[model samples]
Target chain A: MNSSNSGNVGIVIVSHSPKIAEGAADMVRQMVGSAVPLAWTGGDIDGGLGTNVAGILEAIETAWSPAGVAVLVDLGGAETNSEMAVEMLPEDRRARVVVCNAPVVEGAVIAATESSGGSPLAAVKRSAEEFYA
Target chain B: MHDAHASRSGETPVPLTASAVLVNKVGLHARPSVKLTQCAKGFSARIELALAADGPWTDAKSPVKVMRVKAPQGATLHFRVTGPDSKAALAAVLALVHDGFGEA
Candidate 1:
């Protein structure tokens, strides 16, 4: 079912602030257009400053592709929540999603660029993580 | 060019090089840097960029490294490319920069 779209890997951006997540996704869109599936989520269920695992999971579904989804997060809480979200996926879908340890905005931009170029999931994750290394 | 015979015998092959000035209003900001890296990654060459001819070069395919260059308007971008497609890679990158990254 996830493979129905183009083979490009998908990207999900997570942050404590909804604005940050949206801004990062905007940057990715500006650079990559619709070449890759992309989504973003942030803030608590109440729309306050915090990470929402449920929101992240929904974002993962929205951004899902057979090439897999790379999740970029802004802070520790976002990372933890993203991991929880990944764990919530069914076993078959779980292995395909990764919570990358990368800078939220820059990583998303780079990851989307790489994914749009027909790179595989691991390569996309590596390229995003290269932001720090 | 340097002696072809000497270059062939040396451990290091002469890298194809080129330079282009960033004429765009904002220079290598986030948007332009993204374009630059995207173009660079289209080739198989080992491409690097520097502020000077002899430089502390950074990988051209890495957007984060390219963004950190922080090259403002009028700054000359020096490129060093080495690989099977080095010539074409250098030309493509120079063309993109000369086009003002499509922003000018």
Candidate 2:
């Protein structure tokens, strides 16, 4: 079940500014007390989404120990980028990967920091709960 | 443009490097790039973006002009100014870049 991933959760942050991603992740680290894998992809792609997309995919493949992984990004074409990544993954693996609703920086941190005993999906939902609320 | 800021500060106006993060994913594709160019034109600042290597310093205000450059994701653009507001101009451009050509 998708909930199976609640046991382990990982994050990749995409932002307009590299510093913001790094900075936001740092804040989450302090609050949660653990280091989630962090990747940098400025919103403005001078070339294309290939670099950032590749980095996130690679991070997920390596970072997650048991369950699935989550991705959070600033706005604009972030959805497109995330969607593209999701589409490329195998169908079964796709269920494990989810693009989160939390603000890229804040959401990633919260997800990473608050990861406790729930599935990765559950944790991701909680991280973005505030936004929906 | 050389003495753009010289009159204010006797020190020769050194071209400053300003950068912004592309918060969004789509980037300054076309519509947004147009908006960014328009804002850039308002200032007497000379701005150029370094995405790969080839660059054409087009009129910032003209949408048609900027849409030509295909700026994608994960691209770090270098914006330099040598005009009157070169210093502040760089900051503004950088902000817009971070703003994702206005789309973000």
Candidate 3:
């Protein structure tokens, strides 16, 4: 069995729909394999189409990598909640996280691929943002 | 043609070169581009992929540049590699492309 501790940079996908987040993560896994830590948070606590801070925070923890974690959100509310989740982390830990401005699916795919290559947090974020190009 | 000649002017011995058609249904989209970049990174060579057989080349290590080619299904991609592991890099890319990126 392959343990989740592959040492690659981690990735968190935030989306309004659980399906979207999971589907995107699936694509990432298919491309990069299981070497990178990956997690997703979607919908609200009540099963509504909204973003939840706790869920996002937990997702971040699930995918935390010593290299760092990059968060990709689908919409504005998800983006806002993702930032709040990062802020909730310890100050030192917060520095290791970044919220990227890119399409959720494409960003997650690129970020996962870059992270699996043992890239640093910033470079992973940059590669994810390259989706805009 | 022109780009191939231009590349030769550098006097760099490009010992590895190959061309493949994009057989995947979606072509060089985000996922495939990621796969291509990751493969290039595994080698120490300077890898490049171009839209034509001979011309301007973009760093294959850059997912953004790989996506810039916007290669669609049936579009041909040319790969040129230089460095110590150039041959290995070219072989890997050719195999991946031949497999249709596992999307065929």
Candidate 4:
């Protein structure tokens, strides 16, 4: 078997804090490394609105597809903003957006590394695996 | 360019092939890099990444390894994975990139 395509899962990360988003990704590398398909989005971080919602939408449209994509966001605006982004998508595309239910960092890592066959919700659930610690 | 472009349409199942283009303005920093690398480990396929034409190629499943590549904005990496389900890996990569790595 080749080294890269070992899994069929896909992942996406979103956050109100850009640092948090990036930081979370870094932590995952410390543990599992690259083993799944990953995507991410974040707010302006200027403590303002973060990034443009439209930009996030465009990224989602372009990056997510075929088998759909999942999203893991930080608290507060991250969740609301993610909702806005999801709403912007076409009905067909909206079907692919999977939002995570746990802390942003953990959710991002689990979704990115888990072997959930591209299902975001499942990846988020997998993130719960770390809670016992 | 021609051969590379041809593969974008889900053409021939090249041996362990994947691509990473800078979609986020910040490029593949610690966060995305880690996240990207994590996804690479999911599949049983053997994955390798070439940051540039002359750059060193490394395993997609390694974060520290991927970090060394230091993929910057607008920089694109070509990935190759062979073995069963390689096509699935390629598709997932395409989707992630097509999503602009979350920065489009």
Best by lDDT: 1
* TM-score for chain A, prediction 1: 0.95
| The 10-residue segment with the lowest total lDDT in model 1 chain A | A1-10
Give per-residue CA lDDT, model 3, range A47-118, as digits (tens).
989899999999888998888889999999999999999999999899999999999998888888888778
Worst 10 residues of 1 chain B by lDDT: B4-13
Error of 3 at B101 (Å): 2.5
lDDT of 1 by residue, A1-133 (tens): 1212567899999999999999888878877667889889999999899999999999999899988999999988999999999999999999999988888988898898888778889989998998778
Q: Where is model 2 more than 4 Å wrong at Cα? A: A1-7, A35-40, A43-51, A117-119, B1-104
lDDT of 4 at A127: 46
Candidate 2 docks at the CAPRI level of: incorrect
TM-score for chain A, candidates 1 onward in order: 0.95, 0.72, 0.95, 0.69
i-RMS of candidate 2:
19.0
Please write out the lDDT profile of model 4 over residues A1-133, one tens digit for every residue. Answer: 0112433344555666566665765665454455545555566745554655764565455435455555666677666777788888888878667666666666555555544334444443454343333
Error of model 4, residue A77, in angstroms: 1.0
- lDDT of candidate 3 over B4-93, digit per residue (tens): 787655435745778998899999987788888888889888988888877688998887778888889998899988886777789999
Q: Which residue runs of candidate 4 sit more than 4 Å off their true CA positions?
A: A1-7, A45-51, A58-65, A116-133, B1-104
DockQ of 3: 0.52
Between the candidate structures 1 and 3, which one is better when assessed by lDDT?
1
Q: Model 4 scores what on Cα lDDT?
A: 0.60
Question: Which residue window of length 10 is worst by lDDT in model 4 chain B?
Answer: B9-18
Task: Kindly give the stretch of ten consecutive residues in candidate 2 chain B with the minimal lDDT sum.
Answer: B56-65
Sorted by DockQ (best first), the order is 3, 1, 4, 2
